[model samples]
Target chain A: MNELVEFISNNLQLLYILILAIFIGVELIKNVPSVLHTPLMSGANALSGVVIVGALLVMLQAKPDDFLSLGLGFVAVILGILNVVGGFVVTDRMLQMFKKKK
Target chain B: MNITLSIIYLITTIAFVIGLKMLGHPQTAKKGNLISGVGMGLAIVATIFLHDFEVPSINYILIGIALLIGSVIGYFIAMKVAMTKMPELVSLFNGFGGGSALLIGLIEFGNFSEDATQTSTIIAAIIIGSITFTGSLIAWAKLNGSMKDIRLPKYNLINNLIILALIAFGAYIVMYDSTNLMLIYLLLFASLVYGVLFVIPIGGADMPVVISLLNSLTGIAAAITGILFGNMVMMVGGILVGSAGLILTFIMCNAMNRSLSNVIFGAFGGGDVAIAAVGKTGGTIKKTTASDSAIMLNYASKVVIVPGYGLAVAQAQHVIHELEELLTKKGVDVSYAIHPVAGRMPGHMNVLLAESNVAYDKLIEMDNINPQFPNTDVVLVVGANDVVNPAAHNDPSSPIYGMPILDVENAKHIIVNKRSMNAGYAGIENELFFNQKTSMLFGDAKSALTELVNELKNM
Candidate 1:
């Protein structure tokens, strides 16, 4: 816990970015019209798939003898990849429907 | 090198926000999705080559194989699914997101033994992540029509016990020295059980709300993952999703006229009550033919079309679009009144209607269009039942009572197109169909609309 606090104090700039990011996310799109709510929600679903990065990082840092990490990392990597691939692709398909015809 | 990579990461973050902002507007939503996709791709590529100074020691071949396998599975499944099935597919993807986070948290829980805050954070992620994973899967199954709410004896009691146990276990793990692996594993499996039990009692009527809540939890889990890894992009991306999903869930709950707690614990329509309620029939409804409906539409000065899940089921989007166009050309004021939860998915009906090339401006929301229904000469309800049911207002015993519904009942002339007088998906008799102004037009929405088009053409 002390280490974390120390790290936070050291990386005050990144911490500010973190706090600012939340507001930018919350306030800017608060009034998303109902017509776009589902797509907006689904698009956000795709965004949460950003865990793929964290998952891959875990895999990279794991020791070779750490069978648990290897197995868990493998599972994490597969699921993360699936999430990004499926989420963005499906979101694209849904949004494509919003096109107005001439 | 670090500075260059950080710049790339910053660009990726900006791109995600821009994408979400653009996603709010109908005209630019598709473009927004594409923009975000590009941003995600950029982030992935940069991370692969840039982040760690030392080359990654992880087996590159395994990750490659896994990526290949996952991409193929995800790609083909998504492409193969029809728009009507999109919600199920979405739930599955949401489940995957949550499951992955939970898996990572579980692995990390034992590793971060010395740090109290970090350990607690990992445990929180595991609990939320597990709930999201299983809850999403249940939502998917129910949406897919493959699962139903399980009614075990003393179901609520058992449910409470499991929840208490899970919470107690989570707290214990955080306090325990070194966070024993055995306890962590127990926490995971028990949490999974709790997740299933948590969602199993909610009826299909609340599926949309359930899916939205689970989606947000997944977002929250991702945010927690970001904290654990100290990844700025992941944390921001998660906060965006988490915030957006919560907002959407709130909107949907308002639209459905139910509170989030009610959706979670009030034990909505399911099993016995739904069956018994549906078995109760409404008084005889007046029937009308396609020709009469066509004449009504042709002569009416204003028209409102209400589309629901059945509209997608019939694959009648094109026909509905054609009808709207024909009415427009004839100078009739045609608009759509969309209930917030109209279709299976959140915006499923809107997307279906849009796919048919319906004008974006013409699709109206329930709140905006409800008052307009009174002035409507004809309100055509196509494959929608629950949203238009007047029992939401008049019948206290109704499952969907006090729920906000469209004022289709207030319209001058109401025509409902359904294959039968069958109870709707909620298993509640839609009193809207039995309203004095309602006239039943029995047939597939597609065939009925097709017939109406043919009749209008001949006239």
Candidate 2:
């Protein structure tokens, strides 16, 4: 319980940031025209791939002989990269199709 | 935790916000996507270079290899996928993101101990991420037509029980034994099973809601993982995505005039309702020919095309674009009446039409085009059914009752193109088909539109 309280106090700033970012996010996404829903979704989907950083940090901290730890981090990094790359590329492809009237 | 990396993350966060803001307009949306991509790129580069990790060198090699393999596969898949498969691809990507978060949680749990907050966040990440991952896989399978809808009897009750059990089981782990690998594995297994159960009952047409919901789940999972590490960029980015997805899910539900709970629990489009509608005839389906439809379209001063899932199935977007061009050249004011839930996904029809080079201005939203239906000359419903069904508005007994739909019946003439007299995704008889103003032009959308275009050109 003491450790939990200590962690909370230490990370209070991050918690505030998380809450504020959510409000701003909802406000920003509220007005996106329906025509762009798919692209917008795909774009945000890519952003979730930020987990790759955590994967990298974990991989770098794992012991040299700890194959299990290393393997988990490695696969996580791959999946994260796939999400980041595929999401942005697919969103860009979809957005490219929305051309103005000639 | 370093000062320089923190500044980079702050910059990346701002870029994401600005990019999302720019996405509200069509002309700037592509550039907005590019800006976000660049921000992601900067974050990746900064993480690789600036992060202080005191591990062996082989790990770096493995990371490099993984990055290369993932990027190559991702790029090819994105480049090669047809526009019609966008939803499935997005679902697949969402699953990948969730899978990564789940793995992160597992790895972190192994590395950290004796910290209640960290343990709780790790468990939350694992549960949410696993559910998002497996749920998205089911959604992808359903979208691609590889999986059939399976609704066990009393599924809502069953789903509720499973959720309760999971909560109890997770609470047990958190309170009593957070270190038990066996219990954690069991929790993961249960979460995955719940994920499959969550999506198996949902019909394919309701995929937009499911996909959006899962997208948000993945974001929330990522956010929890960020909380585990106290990473600002991950925290902010994931929250943004989480909220964005929530907003879209609500928009999709509102567009259908349904609530989120109703969409998830109603099981409205599972094809069971069709049996109830069987042998209950509404009205006779009046058949029309391509030549007749062409003549009607040619003479009309204003025309609106209503498209749906079948239009994409028949791959008729190109021919439809040609038809629109032919009509426009004949001095007709042509536009599209796009219902919010028109295709398999949100803005699906717009993407299809845009791929065939249909001008964005010509694709009118439902609210803006609904009032114009009364003044419109002809409404050519190509391979669409449910959105134009009058039962939604008038038949209180209908499952889709109260759902806002295109007022195609208000037009002076209605020409519907379909392959058969079958019901749409909701499995209900469309009373609009039998309206005196409506005529069914039966055929595949592509061939029928091609013939209609030929007929109009000869006229």
- In terms of lDDT, the best-performing candidate is 2
DockQ of each: 0.64, 0.80
Estimate how well candidate 1 is docked, as a DockQ score.
0.64
Q: How far does residue B25 in candidate 1 sit from its true spot (Å)?
A: 1.4
lDDT of 2 by residue, A1-102 (tens): 787688779878886887898899899888778888888888888888887777777777888899988999899999999999999999999988986667
lDDT (Cα, 0-100) at B125 in candidate 2: 90
Cα displacement (angstroms), candidate 2, residue B182, comes to 0.9
lDDT of each: 0.83, 0.88
Residue A100's lDDT within candidate 2 is: 68
Show the colliding residue pairs in model 2: none
Q: What is residue B200's positional error in candidate 2, in angstroms?
A: 0.8
Q: Give candidate 2 misplaced runs (Cα > 4 Å).
A: A1-10
Q: Write the per-residue lDDT of candidate 2 for residues B1-459, one digit (tens) a residue.
A: 678888998888888888888776789988988888888888887887787667578988888998998999999999999888999999999999999999988888777846666778888998999999999999999999899899999999998999899888877777775698888889889999999999999877788899999999898998888878888778888899899889989999998998999889988785667677655557677899999898999999999999998899899999999999988888999999899889888899998889999988889999999999999999999988889988888877788889999999999999999999888887888888888888999999989989998999899
Model 1 clash pairs?
none
